[model samples]
Target chain A: MSERTAAPAGQADGRTDDQADRRADRRAERRAERQAEEGERRADPRRRNNRAWLLVLPVVVSVAFTAVIPLMTVVNFSVQDIFSPGDRLFVGLEWFRSVSRDPEVRAAFVRTLLFSAQVLLLEIPLGVLLAVSMPRRGVWVSVTLVLVALPLLIPWNVVGTIWQIFARPDIGLGGWAVNNVLGLEFNYTLDATDAWITVLAMDVWHWTPLVALLAYAGLRSIPDPYFQAAQIDGASAWATFRHIQLPRLRGVLTIAILLRFMDSFMIYTEPFVVTGGGPGNATSFLSILLSKIAVGQFDLGPAGAFSLLYFLAVQIVCYVFFTVLTRTGR
Target chain B: MADIRLEGVGHSYDGGRTWALRPMTWTWRDGRAYALLGPSGCGKSTLLNIISGLLSPTVGRIWFGDREVTGVPTAGRDIAQVFQFPVLYEEMSVYDNLAFPLRNRRRPKAEVDRRVREVSRLLGLEEHLRRRSRRLDPGRQQLVSLGRGLVRADVAAVLLDEPLTVVDPAMKWTLRSELKQIHRDTGHTLIYVTHDQTEALTFAEEVVVLNDGAIVQAGEPSELFLSPAHEFVGHFIGSPGMNVLPAELLDGVVRVGDATLGRASVELPSGPVRVGVRPEFVRIGPAGAASGPVARVTGVDRMGAYNLVHAEVNGHPVIARTDAATTFDAGATRVLRFAEGRAFLFRDAVRCGALEPLDGRAGA
Candidate 1:
């Protein structure tokens, strides 16, 4: 593009050098000004406010007791074979190896991951669609906001119970619709595919409103001039959304995607209540299986190892995705 | 380029109860640069929106050349606008940002490429074309916004809404001149809306000044400066503005109160009038020397190039711009003289005429 410039080569070069010098001078002046400000701040007597740190001490100590200490205790338990609180044998690496090698655990891990992936794929676009179609202003805004938020207001276990009864082939409204209206044999208890579909659908129904709400908030924050500019530029509705609305949504969508990923990855309650880890192992997420090991069988050592691994997996994926998604646009 | 003509264009946000812009007939000549200048809430933006078709005027018809486009959409109006803050597709590269409008219209690729490159070169944004528009500084982002408008060869006019508001002061001169240069090179009619008098006066061939949703004056910058049509225009167009002192006009003698200032010989109706004077045209002298009203010097402000001598004439405060070397003690007595043929008399806030001879004797 620069090669097409009409300016004489020598003058352009001179102008470039002049601009570079001016920019460097401005940057240096700004740095000096910042340093001067910092020096003044340091000399200010108000900087010696030591009591503010003390005000935060209670929160820090409570978090340490509740989270950090228990996490450290879990790390300790993961490496030991504990029959009782005092009777324990240090068996490092054994539990970790067995947990990693366990076929049931491996299958559950894959199943949970697949569930999260499908949840995101189904929710993100659907949520954005719902948000786009939602009224932006006037009385309808409050009305629609209340309507879309109704599903999110229900408790997770209640959602599970409602769907559990609702998807039953014998008498429930949804299951009966599929069985008689759609004329399909759709018993979740008898078929693995049916169970998966029911669990996925229930999760979508319960949580999609969350994504829609977040996307709606994001859409509202964009100022009016952007849309007006797009209209003046002869952009179609799709073009306006693709160029103006979607690009500005990056910040909030990043947050929404991260929250949804973390939430879906750790999801257990709704699926557990609805399918109870399924007729087979179809819906046995890692959390449900780990609950069986830890609370049901009371195998503290193996459960500790399983939980640590689970925590590590969630951490790695969330961190990697957060970094990539946040930085990719820039 | 198409000449824009609006006949009785006006807007009312609350149906027809109140108008943001009062209906006014005006014509914008093709290839001529114009400015809609006013204070905030003066309906300049509303006028621009109406012309650009973003708004439909409550009462009136509009035309672009010979075409009646009062009911047309903004895109169909074939005009482009740059907003106060830079609006860009943050995820798109500067090249794509420049190409967006053309691509949206499904223009031929070759024409899009040519026009995009031409606009980038024009804006000095050639080197930044591949960079993400969001990553650039605000000034450059504004340039990309302007480029998106300029990249279309068929654009009839470009409207700017305080485009320099977000630009750094150092870059304002460059961007402003770049806009002027674009106007010169392409000859697209440009209508800029700004509350800034400097931006309007410097960039436009004609400035339409608005006050209280009404057209106060629309003329050349020099005309607005020298021969302001309304008192509001006089107060708004200049830095430190034109001074307006209330006085009585009777029997050809202009008096601030009981003190006589000067006499006007022109056929002027005798009533209350405002004596308007630019600070630059006011001359100060020792008391009892000049043939004018005696004033007490309140203070002197040295403003680098000139000194502002603040004084009071018959309890009315007045500011006189003098040479920087001049100084006066506070509370000193001085006579204020209005330069011959420069001071004007305004009856009911409308210009009556230039102040006539200083001698008390009326001309035959």
Candidate 2:
């Protein structure tokens, strides 16, 4: 402080240094005054506004009523054999052990995970490719956007129903075209492989547009000069996308991947509509099996156990995806 | 390195409706620095983009030395550009940023490394080479972008469009000198576009000033300062600019109100003319007993190096620049004098010639 208050010795006259010293001294005094006021403010809680917490009451109440209460009920059902709410008997952890050991449940878990993986793998690159190819301006931009977003606007069950009929070899044009045009024998209802492929294709078709639109929005936010710079740098079409467009799309793509992952992992409607857990349970994902156990067979306790396990898996995977994707995006 | 020649180049956004740049022929000689200076929307950036092959001219041809590149793409043109904003890949380290151009051209890994290191050293970015390009300050990011251009040895020229707008003031001086030094060291042709006269004057050997989508004047710094070819050049090139007052020309004698300013030996214009003088050459002295136009001092602006004494003569505004030691009082009256040969006469805003003040001191 003294060194700052006074100019270095022998460098200049003290008359100017006197002015410097006075200015520094005033600055120090102001700093002290600010510190004193801050100290008082810290010491006196009554002087501060503490009502900011009240603004969060609605959120707390909503979350408690929606997420917390339902979650606690699921937890309670997982540990009890309940014929009626008041006539319930505690069968601690028995449902968990049986459900965890069940071969069908284990297979469905793997199937769901594999489906999510396939969905991401097929959708992300295809979406990015579509985004990169889309028009940036002119009247065609609106047309292209509308066209790309068409698949996303369809109802989930409708998408499943459409694909189910569409894959029928006899009456559906798509299946007939595949069979007659390519000369490939294809039947989704009779073949396990065909059923799985049908469900996967259905998911990919319905979800890829979301990724593409997100990536397109990301690409749009980047300024034009980056592309101009890349062009002048002698970058080819692929190189430009690799260095400029792809990196710029990192944020939106992260969101896209997370949304796709969560949606695909928890997916039940589209596959259920199309495959109905399919021939010999080939398309029976975790959600479908859980519903079958809970609603069809009325095994409330085991279904509750399955629900918690599914939630836990989603939580762990989402956390990992959020961390890894955000870190790499940075 | 090669001369960039633009012949009859012009552009219009709406199909021959309104012009952004009128067709003109120009050549920037090899291994020299030139600045395209103008106000906003004066076609400076448009001209730069045309030269860089980012925007092809709607008419006429472009040549890089003997090679006619009128139809070439931006990537095909051997020119590099620094935009108004720094353009760098955020995910890449400074090393990769600098090596991007070379890598895009499929240069060998060793060669890319060598060029990256060399350019990074030139930009003083050696220490931050391993850091991501986004981590640097704006000035340093601009330097990295500049390094990307410099990394390619075969580049014909380097173009800059208001590259220093985002730099901090203190860093501006350093970056300007660094750019000048790099030009000198590399002997690469540089074309800089800016609205700032100081940046243009300091960085370029020649400056082309534009106004309203047309070239106003083009000349060396001293020529621009001493003998502006256009009234706009005089106004745009200097601090405080030049003061202009409406006048009439009678057989080459320039007269403003009742004062005979000077005479030009060139062909006389009987129509209206204007008297142009830099405030530095306009002198304010005590009135009375002098056969000169009197002015009423309105205000004095105290600049650090000088005082600007604004006054009115025959209801025409005139400003006189005096040293810091000199001052004038408001409402005081004085005789206005022009330094001999420093004042000019302009007809239709085009400079006619220097004026020979009728004052006898201009004789001997």
User: Which candidate tops lDDT?
Assistant: 2
In candidate 1, which residue ranges exceed 4 Å CA deviation?
A: A1-64, A81-89, B251-253, B259-270, B285-291, B325-329, B332-335, B352-355, B358-364
How many Å off is the CA of B110 in candidate 1? Answer: 1.8
Q: List per-prediction Cα lDDT, in the order shown.
A: 0.88, 0.88
What is the alpha-carbon interface RMSD for each candidate? Answer: 0.9, 1.0
lDDT minimum window of 10 residues, candidate 1 chain A = A1-10
Instruction: Report the Cα lDDT for residue B131, model 2.
Output: 96
**Interface RMSD (one decimal) of model 1:** 0.9
Residues A227-292, candidate 2: write the lDDT tens digits.
999899888888889889988888898899999999999999988988889888999989999999
Write model 1 residue lDDT over B1-364, tens digit each, in one string: 6789989988999998888999989899999889989999989889888988998999999999899999999989889999999999888899999999998889899989998999998998999999989999998999999888888888878999998999988898887887888899999999999999998999999999988888878999998888777888888988788878888888887887656777774777788888888887788977777456788999998889999999998888999999999989999998777777667888767777767765643210
Taking every candidate in turn, the Cα RMSD to the unseen true structure, in Å, is 7.4, 7.0
- The per-residue C-alpha lDDT of model 1 at residue B43 equals 94
lDDT of 2 by residue, B284-360 (tens): 76776455567899999998888889999888888889999987789999887888778888878998777775556
